[model samples]
Target: MSGARGAWWARIPEPVLDAVVVVVAVVDVLINLDDTSGPAWAMATLACAALIVRRRFPLPVFLLTLPASLMLDIVFAPFAALFTLSERSRDRRLLVTCALLFAVASATPWPLDDLSSHERAWTLVYFFYTLATAAAPVLLGQLVQARRDLARRLVEIEEAREHERLLHSQAVLARERAQLAREMHDVVSHQVSLIAVQAGALQVAAKDPDFREGARTIRSLSVDTLDELRHMVTLLRASGGRSTELTPQPTLADLHKLVTTSGIDAELTGELPPDVSSTAQRTIYRTVQEALTNVRKHAPGATATAHLWHDGDAFGVTVTNTPPARPSLPLPGSRQGLIGLKERAELLDGTFASGPTGDGGYEVRLRIPNRAG
Candidate 1:
């Protein structure tokens, strides 16, 4: 539609359009008049002036030149309909317009004085040559625009693909965070419940010094465990407990109380890595603690061993115990302690496996990578 409007203005026949196209062409030749003169100069002016209507009524302007040029003969200009076919449009319009332009060009200079009678007999030959030459520049411009449009579309497709990838990544992160929160809730609640049960038992059995000492140990473990649980909650709320009230995090050194409170014979075989920060140590401690709790509940008579080793890149831990002599006792309720331990190991870029070991024993192994907290 815009192309049609521009073409209509070009062929408006207003004094301004006529004067600009005609005067410009004449001035162009006058500036280089020494190089060419006569028929060529007048024809150049007519071609320039006729082009004002080339985009709007291309076929009509080309036809108009035929009668007007026949009257003036040597002074007529060649018609160029090249501009009409340059824009993106239907093929039918281009074919009709080009045919009309060729007809006008063929009839205008009939019976050329410079050619032999045999050559002049076929005027259509010269008409086709002129049509091809005039259309060359417009065809080149259209090809360039087509290539540019294809490049723009390719860039748009790449950007849309990148946006979808980012959306998928955000959704996965949200799901993992929710799963981690659920695991933490189960682990902390299980530990607190066990501490409460032990405290109640000690209250009735305190006549013995061993029972009195066990009661004190339970008090200490409960306090320390609550502090770690609070720290975990703070981490869930934000990045860490920076702005919240939090007790100091536990390390491998704190595993002593954890084993003591459980009232089990736990033989420690290897040393823990001293170089790693508090977080990794705490994670290892919690994993061992959870594995021991499982042993106590499911295999009460089994003797347990806690092993910790450092092999340069990671801290390796193993908690293993023998089978129970009697039927396994059921705790108050089943809890997700092992699931939380796995989550804690993964958060630190670690690997974990827990199940029955060969030789009728159960074992849990964790390998936590040594990275800066």
Candidate 2:
């Protein structure tokens, strides 16, 4: 019922509530004027006016109402001011000071009365009653303030979560845009490169001056198109503001040199056929490079073992690295290399597998069928 009353009061607009305070104070003064003298009546009237601005200046208004309450039979003016001051006060000094003053005023007898020394027990009971009355309203005010603060905090948290969700959505859209640009580049670049090669063949085979000149023009146009396509791809990649290494593509023959120069302790077992196609060689080369790179990145200063063999109709390659012993500058990667490698192997109707070993190391395996030219 207290909660329901508080909620109902909370819905009351501030200006209307302030007006209600003035009306109530005026009524109190009118009803209790007969019990007080002329000076007390005048003070109570002024306090009733002060109640109009009690919320804006609670402490000052409470001071006005305190005197009026002491000298007159008006109860609501002082109690209302007490509740407002306690509810709105941010300073500890104000709350404590106002509380003590109200307790003292409530405990004291305003009208002179003859009482004997035997009424000491009655004094104690009156003191306890006054103290409890002073405390109860202040506690209620504190509870109301706490509820308001909690509501504000909940609203702020919800707004923050909504902002985070918006940012995540933007990030997802950007990644999809980059992926689409990449697909366009790969497909377009490969076809243009083939056209350039065919044009070069035409230039070499033509005999007539006119035909040779036409072939030369076609070759030049195709080469220029391929270059433009490469530039577009570079721009797309750089749009994300991520750093990229500007190095030449690695191949199978560069494996030995890579392992040696990178200062990585690795053992290569079995051998690759010397007469393999460039496509096959490039796939094998990049797979080895990516595997070794992961080893150096995740487990620096650890020993890695690689095994490559031609098994009947398919070629199998496996690379495994142990955990690092001595920690070094850890490298960062998105593990996108493994994802690309899986796609690469699948395109060639091959198999790719990678995971942790039994000894807490990492392993990657690839099996390529020999059926492709």
Candidate 3:
């Protein structure tokens, strides 16, 4: 109900406001006036006209109303005009003006006839008290407005800061993903190119039966590796497209291809747990890939053993290889594959470690917690 009235009041025009304030002020003067035939009534009416622009020019309103209030006091009229003047012109600057007007007006003779000194002092006290009362509402309104504006500004700043942080994080993640894709492309492209070149040479040397058989095996491994690598690239592209591409994730089922491509003889040891799911399976596969790549590059003549063991809540994989007895040939490429695998495992709250064993063999170990736990 009050809201409806406020909405109605908002549609009132400036001209209407001028007419209303003048009417109210004139009514107030006439209601309390004992005699209404002098300069006091004229001054009061002029003061009402001056109040129409109080919001735009409060200082002028203060000046106009102060003198009018003094004139009203001189006419033996009630002192309500001074109180009304203070109500109309009480802001930060106008409060000081009002206090000054009160002090100056108190020094003059009262409109009351033959007043006692005590009665005069009481009237002066009443004037100051009225000025204080008028200042209370304006000061409280200003404080409430300042607090509400401050809270609104703080909320806006926090939302903007959070948006900036999200954008920065997305940019960093995009850069890292692009770098990883580039590295994978370089590694796969090099290995595939080598296999293709070697296969072409073997086809030419087919007359030499012994060399031909070895070349055929290399060719086969090369073809299979290329197919797998292409599938991986497709999967990356598709998943990166919509993130719902359900091209089957690699699992322990593909372990044989890894061994064959590495050109290493691996003796598998244990059974994979029934509960080993997508995440752990991928981690294991990548670990084997990295280990075998290192074996082919660094341990050329060494044999590797791939083992998987499941006991209770933890599952483990070990890839151990006897290193080349002779001086190590230059290891090909930057060896960041195992480092990346370790980081992947750690992100899933697993453990991974790889280094040379005391018995002149390289060993890579990984342990992942089972899902049932």
Query: Best candidate, lDDT-wise?
Result: 2
Summarize candidate 2's per-residue lDDT along 1-373 as a digit string, tens digits. Answer: 2354468777799889988888888897788676568778777878888878888988899898777766776667877887888778756677767777766665556665766575656755776777677777677777766665555445444554675587567656556656756886778888887888888898899999899899889889989988887887776665432222221344566667766654478988887666656666666767877888777656655898878788668886789889865333433558799999998888888889999999978999988888852
RMSD of each: 27.2, 20.0, 26.0
The better candidate by lDDT, 1 or 2, is: 2
Candidates in order have lDDT scores of: 0.62, 0.73, 0.64
Greater lDDT among 2 and 3 belongs to 2
The worst-scoring run of ten residues by lDDT in candidate 3 lies at 74-83
Q: Residue 65, candidate 3: how far off, in angstroms? A: 1.8
Which tens-of-lDDT digit does each residue in 92-124 have in candidate 1?
Answer: 466546545545555456333586676666656
* lDDT agreement of model 2 with the native: 0.73
- What TM-score would each prediction reach against the true structure? 0.35, 0.54, 0.39
- Candidate 3, residues 1-373: lDDT per residue as tens digits? 2333356655798778667766776666566566655776776777767666665665566566655556554311112233334344424575556555644553444353777889778777867765565455445544544444445445444554675587566556555554555566688757786887889697777898888888887888888887777777655554442222222356788887767755556666677876677778888888887787677556645789989987777887899999653233343466678779889788678899899999888999988877522
Please say which candidate is ahead in TM-score: 1 or 3: 3
Cα deviation of 326, candidate 1, in Å: 79
Ranking by TM-score: 2, 3, 1
TM-score leader:
2
- Cα deviation of 352 in candidate 2 (Å)? 44
Worst 10 residues of 2 by lDDT: 240-249
